[model samples]
Target: MDATQPELKRALGLLSLTLYGLGTIIGAGIYVLVGAVADRSGMSAPLAFLLAGVLAAFTGLSYAELGQRLPEAAGAAAYAREGFKSHWMGRIAGFLTLAVAMVAAASVARGGAGYLLTMIDIPLPIASGGVIVLFTVLACWGVKESVYAAGAMTVIEVGGLLAVIVIGGPALADLGVRLPDIWPADLNGWGGVMGGAFLAFFAFAGFENIVNMAEETQDVGRTLPRAVVLSIIISAVLYMLVILIAVLSVAPDLLAQSDAPLCLVVDCEKSTMAFFAPVALIATLNGVLIEIVLMARVAYGMARRGWLPKLLSDVHAGRRTPLKATLAVGAIVFALTSFVEFQVLAKATSAMLLLVFLVVNLALIRLKQVDPAPHLAFRVPNWAPVAGAFSSILLLGAEVLA
Candidate 1:
């Protein structure tokens, strides 16, 4: 950028961005979807999460290579443009990213409102919209401010997960007996696990969001790739342990029934309700905030590349943020949250994300073919994106047939 132009401040380092990465994947994804996955796979819930994690890793590696190869705010869009050699493809990718981010944020907000209503009576629209408005203000204030809030919230949420593990830890003693149930030996059992993996895949959606922050991150090539890989590995490990504990502590059917699955793990019967309410709220809010920040950067990136209105490309002088873009994205998120049901939003968001991943992985494959010169800081195996693309297609097909 020219000296006169305001650019995104590169204030994020490894720790902050990695925490942000954790926040993106861990919050609403695991918080809400765990039980649903259990509902599908029963005792084999951990396997479903493991399957999802493996698939995500393939795409995550593709993203790491892409992020290092081209560290831009546009992220997938930039990769699409370079790979397809068409400006039009970049615009398509940008809009797809915006749509997925908004829907994902809305779903998380709607889910958060459910948690809020249990604590106190309020209209769903008001509860959800209020959260969106609050976070939009935070995102526009500054990236550092937003990341700090997110990092603190991430720690709190992680603590909540640790609490669940502790409460359910003893359940593992039954592992010797439960081992047989946890593995699927027959076609019927394996089918259930595959179905669960389809839903579990959605929880892995947020790692790609890390790439959108490339412009605002320090040492883009090194930090972005490492953060992507670290977040996926860490989130994957935590997910398996938590899901295993959850399925063991409670019947898969029982855990499946709860809106707050982790709370069920706490075995809370004494208090007002699930003792985990406060932490769940913060986790949900952190997710929505990350989504809003991601969508704004996508809008700003697209605008800067002449795909959207130039006004969206404009940055706030004092805050060094894409103010108008943030406000616009937040408004869209609120509207969707107010109107759409959580299930519909989740399904749509997951489908769009998979479709985008398919395209992005393909973009990486093509780029790899034409631009083979090594990026020494980061590079995935030649077969990585190929597998990523195939897995995406396989999952999409599986979901459709089911």
Candidate 2:
């Protein structure tokens, strides 16, 4: 049987697409990157996040362009296939993209378990593995159910962060604006701020996941670019605000020391709100898990298209989920979880994602020149793709340098 003939449903709307994008982008970075960013950027953590967001915006535009032209699942892989006309290269691009995604999910899973363990004094590995398995099971049930769960979780995730902002507003105001000492005499110099930008960019990484949903999203030609651009901007702004609050509410040094910086800052001022830590952790986990599920689906889609090994293309007849690909990815995530630390996992994911983004921008530029689909539902000015391609190349260089 021709694999593509076994059609999957396309039931997602613009709102569902946006929620998935938002949820995936907003996770672990806010929970996990605060201290890492604070330590690297000093008082300039928000600035770093802002810069990273700007960099990510360029690539986001590139994705918007290709998503319209290809408008299929396995977003980057599809783009690569069309852009380069090489199935082998497309497979490599798609595989690395999905690999980083699984690595990210496992990293967050372990981190969530650590938070759970610390919160309740349970064994870390066992708790983390259990959570990962449960999330994978949920993903294998069906995309329809996953979309609803993802949308609901995104709301709670956003609310949890907002709750922190509201509860910490007074504390932040009391502290006044504590800028990271940019001057050499005060703290980390300019070099450190750039380094922090590298770290902060991770928070904005999920926008690419939007590309993978092109096959399932409603009105792909019109909605994908706008959704991609808007989601990237919205999530970046929220990250900036949250980091800014954390930076100002507590001393930078103190904020950098804890694993849970936002909660620690909140706890410092109003210990009564300590109950929200696990809530935040759950929010982050849900977001990461959703993205991983999306990644696995993308992998399965690619395999079905013959871009990957046939083994990964199989869908369970009963559930119609990409059970084979899901298990393969889960196994890789578990292996990496055992061996790697969060910093390594995050940076590696960033590096792999940067490569995919580079290709996406290139594909957009090439597609514009070769195909020139002026009637695309989402059209950027012709020059935007050029600029987006150039900027993405530069950032990819920087990602490598970092």
Candidate 3:
């Protein structure tokens, strides 16, 4: 924590936190993972999404405990610093969290740009930059405005997914419901499934984002944990439902080939709802907007605490937003988008995310022993945190083994 800087305002309510969680959840994962999982699991792509959700839930419990204890910006960093009792561990955790944010912004920016091109005749790069610029400006404006925009975007994105479900409901009903062989009985056979799990982890990226709002949230101890766990559950269910309808409504092989799987679903089983593609695309664009703002805020928070360049700590006087940080984050994301291979970017995201979650879990265990917080708005059962931490470690090992 920067002793010199003024304390960040806590303006986020539970609803805002929920929106932040949801906005973070509905990003490139939904746009990209459907095909990747379909390819890996054949017809059981929905199961891959569910498996990823379960893995994320364990991490979520760990986060709920620590997020309640720490309720500070640089969420993972606070936990790591307090838990490990080491400055370096905190620094590494914060760095990895920022790394995930950068890649997330890049992926969402690229996805938003693609959506814009599909809706219009604009050049892809130019449209992508436009999306980045829009988000950068919003983030530089302030947290309150960004939260409002994020909340609205969450609704629109959820509406898009709901549209898909409503349209595909009849088809889903027609196909007898049964759990497929998604979670292989061998469990050891997940050697092949790890890649898809890594891909699906993208959906859970937004949960850590709540820590960025520590400065802006009201009653950080009470609300942060609620937001963390509830938002993850909400987003997970929504994502699973979207995947279920999307995979079952069409041939899994065909979905594996389609680039815009939801759009393809709409074009096929729900042609009447085809008009909503534009709406869904717009919602995705809004999600990118929220992501860019969050990326900037987290970077700003880290910098204020001396984790990054001090220059990033600058805030616009009128807007009270981290203008310099917003610009810097946008530039970094844009450069990555322009130069790096997407697959490498995605894998890097997965690896960094795993580390961040592991640190958060450790933070909870550490704080429980060192600085026990009481009467938190939320608390995980004692064993849940331990189980969650080990689960994260195992999943990370699996990812590495793959």
lDDT of 3 by residue, 1-402 (tens): 444555555678999888888888876678656766777665566666777788888878777777666666667777788888888998898888878888877766555544455556876667667777777778777788888888887788788778777877776664465444444555554554665767788767788777678778887877888888888888888888778777777776777776566777777335566566566666656656766777777777678678889988876666767788888878877676665644566667777788788778777776777655666766676677676677667767877776
- The sequence of per-residue lDDT tens digits that candidate 1 reaches over residues 285-370 is 78999999999999999888989898898899999999999999999998888898776787788788988898899999999899
Colliding pairs, model 2: 43-180
Clashing pairs in 1: none
lDDT of 3 at 1: 45
Candidate 2 lDDT (Cα, 0 to 1): 0.73
Misplaced by over 4 Å in model 1 are 1-3, 271-275
Work out the TM-score per prediction: 0.96, 0.91, 0.91
Q: Worst lDDT window (10 residues) for model 1?
A: 267-276
The global C-alpha lDDT for each of the candidates, from Candidate 1 onward, is: 0.86, 0.73, 0.73
Model 2, C-alpha of 345: deviation from truth (Å): 0.6
Give candidate 3 regions above 4 Å deviation.
1-6, 174-192, 268-271
1 versus 3: better lDDT goes to: 1
Q: Which candidate number maximizes TM-score?
A: 1
Candidate 1 local lDDT, residue 262 = 72
- Tell me which of candidates 1 and 3 scores higher on TM-score: 1
